[model samples]
Target: MDEVPGVPAGLLGGHPRVLAAAAATGRLPGRAALDDYRAAGARAAESGVPLRVLVETALVMAESMDPVPLPALRRAVSALMEGYENAQRLALRQEEVARREFVDDLLQGRADRLAERAEHFGLRLAETYAVAVARPAVPLDDGSVRDGTVRDGGGVVRDGGGVVWDGDGPARRIEEAMVARFGSHNVLVAVRDGGLVCVVPGSLTVATGEFTHHVRQMFAPGWRVGLGRPHRGPGGVVTSYREATGAIELGDRLDLRAPVLKAADLLVFPVLLRDRAAIEDLVTTVLSPLREARGGPEPLLGTLEAVFASQGNQTAAARRLGVSTRAVTYRLERIRRLTGFSPDDPTQRFTLETAVLGARLLEWPAHAPG
Candidate 1:
């Protein structure tokens, strides 16, 4: 009997029926060889051989024997393909378990060797990266709940409700989409903190508006995304992740409904919210008159934002507000009389803008305590 190169002798030595069948038919035995091929498939999977290589090896071994009937050879190849596919699925499941463990450790701050661990998963940690977090706009049905936790790309564990969004469907879609755009190795999407989190390469200089538009179009209408500023290194990934979560939290608190919120644009409110007493004081002292205005605080606040956004240009601000320039001037005059701060002066304009920002952050007049 001819020996198969690179295969251990013991593998075939113990399977005499397989050898006899091969000798007689010049092809692997049907049904009889299934057990032997299954063993071979398991070993191939363990050795990390590609399924293509395993299929090729099976064909080569079958052809090496004296001429076998075409029908018999075809049957043998189909059986080998089935065995290889089964083994491949098993191998993939095992790999996913290991990858999830590594990702969990990395996110929990337990993995000290970031570069080494990242490389093991075919990731490059040296490049600039940003984290994006997404949550569903609608709640999932209770029946869809499987375990207390669901492992998507990465895993997330939550308290209270004891449920976190699996994000399996959307997270896979996100990873596939980003990979298609940026290449397979450039993006990583995981499920964390009841949402999908993606680590994408490139600096903030990359047009976030364009990226946000793409995400909004690609994802389902129910998804809301938040992006962090780009930073370098594996450790910086944690910082970026925190920034992404903060953006989502702040956006929800302030009721900003843009499809994607950028952490860079929300830098001030989060810090100001940390000093709640100061924010309250600013609302009380500088914004009290506007709160007591005849038409309510929203109209004046809207005008202030428009004026500031237009850089004190009454004509431009009026255009944006869909009002006449004289109306814009009247609003600014009312603001000056009520708050004792003139919008015409750059210095007072700065203070008034700061106070308005504080009021919005605190949701003053609407939710302020009496």
Candidate 2:
């Protein structure tokens, strides 16, 4: 084996040695050689060695057996190669399974030897980590994934719960892009609960921007990305993941138009939702009068939302609503007259804006509980 040209010392194994002996004997190796080759292939896959190199080395070993019949040697090498390929496939499947399990544990905050497992995947539990989650604006299909086999729009529905996607979907593409930008060691991308989750060191200020860039490339205007603040330790991964997921869900509920949302920026929303009774009461009391308007609460509600969104500028609100400034003024007056809350007064404006946000959050009038 040492005498074989172009064969690295680390790659020298019983399989090649057995094949050489069989070639010298003008016969192919039996089962033992096949088992050795399979083991070698698994090692090669783990060490990042190319199969082409292995094949070329085998050819060199075959060539060295001068005056020996080539048929037996060729057959021996063929058997060895088959074993190698089979082992490589097995190694790959096992690697994928390990990765999936590690990601699930990390994101779900499962602490069963999680710190030790994190090291296996190149994660440093001492460092702070942030999570970014992304999904298509419109889900691939309306079907629920079952038995870990359903694939929709490149997403797989996990049997346990939520989408667990794989293959050549947006998740794969995003993973590739992120790895290309940040290097594989710096980022971990996985499909969990039906969306793509990217875990990157929180210190990388541009990480989320890079994530957003890649997501936008694949799903412009139709995708949403939620970013969670970085937290330290293994549990931090789970915390950040939850924050990212929460941001995405909140954005959906609030009808937020922004493609990118940060959990830190929307902190007030969770606070508002914490006391549901208080918010519901606020919405019903301050804005209920608009229900009596000619077109019901929607028109008046839109006026308030637009006015507040425009920072009290009637002209900008009008532009947003696609109505004339005079119309906006009239609507504002109608709201004041109907609800006794004026958008022009500073204190009243604050109360009106909070109620309006609560209304959107509660899906008032249209879906609010009767």
Candidate 3:
């Protein structure tokens, strides 16, 4: 008789029918053979047999033991189930450890064998991918908030207020939800730095708006999402992750009310923030005059914001500000006189618009030291 791998040799030696079943299905016998099956499960776990395969083996073993007395076989099946559960748990735990290590490597850009490691973690490195970062929208009332910077495992410091997420329950729930929306194998989620970061494949074809809407509905209110644009390859994934992080930081700084923010929509902020000295200079040179306006900077700043938001259309700006078009035009004229830059000119408009964005990001007059 041919020997079955990982199965004890002498255990099924006497039963020809059981031996044939084991040989054909790669399942151990059952009933009086419970001990051997349990042992086989342990060996399989150690040998790296997949949990799904082990489960099927257990079911097949129960079916093959049908000729045994019903009550006795039922007891044996119960024992087999326990053994399978233990083996699966052990395998799953080990996989989790390996997966965490891979994620850390990926995030840190230290993964040399990217393709091999990604495949081991059931990820397709070559596929188009995007990264998303989600955090609890509501700050904890407890004074546990830390004042310093919060950095992820990858050592990327996301500039935002920190929250101490105390448990894995929410993270796990998010992972399950993402897997349900995008298939289990296509999405990899890990909780890092008190937030959930997910690497999801683009093959799911879910639109960004729809994806964020679904995520918001799945979680509790006040959950904010930062989604990155899709890019190809593992390096692209890292880039997307950085974009997602930047989106969150920018959104928070700007006090954007939208629950979901896309990185692509806010690329200009990062570019402007890249040169701190330059942005500060621009704000000082163009907007400093507004601080000395007749009614103080608030009214002029409000007018400027309204006009820019309305795309330089004085009529639209006036409607938004609940004032007459002539009033809006007069404010724009005052702005030009004070700053020597007219909002109506294309070149000056670009400069003023950029400066306005910089002021918002820096919290300008509000950021002035007390």
Candidate 4:
């Protein structure tokens, strides 16, 4: 009749039996529980060994007697309680460390493993997976931290929902939540310096109108996030990661909301972003009046856009605008006379086309007929 069936410690000593006795019956060993402790001892003598023996040893080892010897029994009990608390805390700290080491080992093995896992994850998801760039909400020495990454080293994205929700310590909770939303089990999160990486599945890769709100909620105090286009497998994952990084970098360079630039912008030059300045003058001076409907020149701004898009090809421009070719020529001549841009010149045409797009962004006045 050992106090606890699963544990056997009686061979070591009687002291351990006290802990085993208390643990077995779910009661602190009073004189009554001591009977169980004794029974555990008896069982140990008969069987190979009983758990109570070692448990008793542990209990005794944990005991610290006060030299003064005032109320020694009470003091001993208090010391035992303290030891239990300490043991619990230490165990928790050790477990946390162990988990971290586990993750590190997984990361060190080779990206190939993660790649393989991510591919399976991607297939399981059967949906387009996107890599989001998470930046710190606040600025850092090298670059800004992406959102939530500081709070939760890795975030799991949910389907149709932004990963803005705080996940408990599981670290994979956010991903699990996404699993619920997207209806897939293939999801993984990898954390790297400066960002959190995620693998998702599905066909359309970009965060849609549905995800925008969640992105802000997922945002943390010190980090920001920019989502990358959805990609497939390793190539897609890498592409999305690069895009997310680019978005963060580009966002950092531009004032918030100057615009959300995409990965394609990486190939563009600084001059091109500012080059829109060249078209500002033409738009403000010539196209402004044309856009005015009440007592303004006939609305030829549409005409202007079509003409520019066509590279000044009057026939093509006419077809595009649903106007006759002759009508297209008249509008082209009208534009040249009003704005000093001769549609025949290829260079002038290029400038006008670029200007139109830039003008829309710069918030310049409409084209006014000269």
**Which candidate tops TM-score?**
2
lDDT of 3 by residue, 1-370 (tens): 5544554444334444544455566665565577765655565555666555655443454454535344444444455456655666555545555666677678777767878988865688878988887766543211124453322211211113453322234555556677776666777877555556788776654634444655576556877888888888878888888888788888877766677788989988989989988998898888998888888776777788788888878899899889999988888888898999988889998998898888888888788422
Count of residue pairs whose backbone atoms collide, per candidate = 0, 3, 0, 50
Model 3 spans > 4 angstroms off: 1-90, 138-170, 180-182, 202-210, 293-303, 312-347, 366-370
Deviation in Å, model 2, residue 345 alpha carbon: 1.4
lDDT of 2 by residue, 131-152 (tens): 9988776453222344555454
Per-residue lDDT value at 350 in model 2: 90
lDDT of 4 by residue, 1-370 (tens): 3334444543324444545444455455565434444454444434544334434544444353222232332333444344343344344334434433333333344353554443433443224566654454532211122243434443222212222322242234433455566554444454455344444554534323223334345545545566677765445656666676767666554323423345555444234456555455655654554443434443355666676666667788788778898877776677677667765787877666555544544434433223
Error of 2 at 82 (Å): 6.3
Stretches of candidate 1 exceeding 4 Å from the true structure: 1-36, 64-76, 111-116, 122-170, 173-188, 200-217, 221-235, 252-265, 293-295, 314-334
In model 1, state the lDDT of residue 2.
62
Which of the two, 1 or 3, has more lDDT?
3
TM-score of 4: 0.38
Where does model 2 exceed 4 Å of error? Answer: 1-48, 64-86, 138-165, 367-370
Winning model by lDDT: 2
Q: Decide which is better by TM-score, 1 or 3.
A: 1
Per-residue CA lDDT of model 1 for 1-370, tens digit only, reads 4655555444334344454466675774666667666676667666666667666655665554555445555665566566666666555544544655666665555766767878766677777778777776643221123565443333342323444433344455655666677665666655454576677775534534434555576555867778888877776777777888788877776656576788999888778878888878877888788866888988898898888888888899899889999998988888889999987888888888888887777777777746
Query: What TM-score does model 1 achieve against the real structure?
Result: 0.67
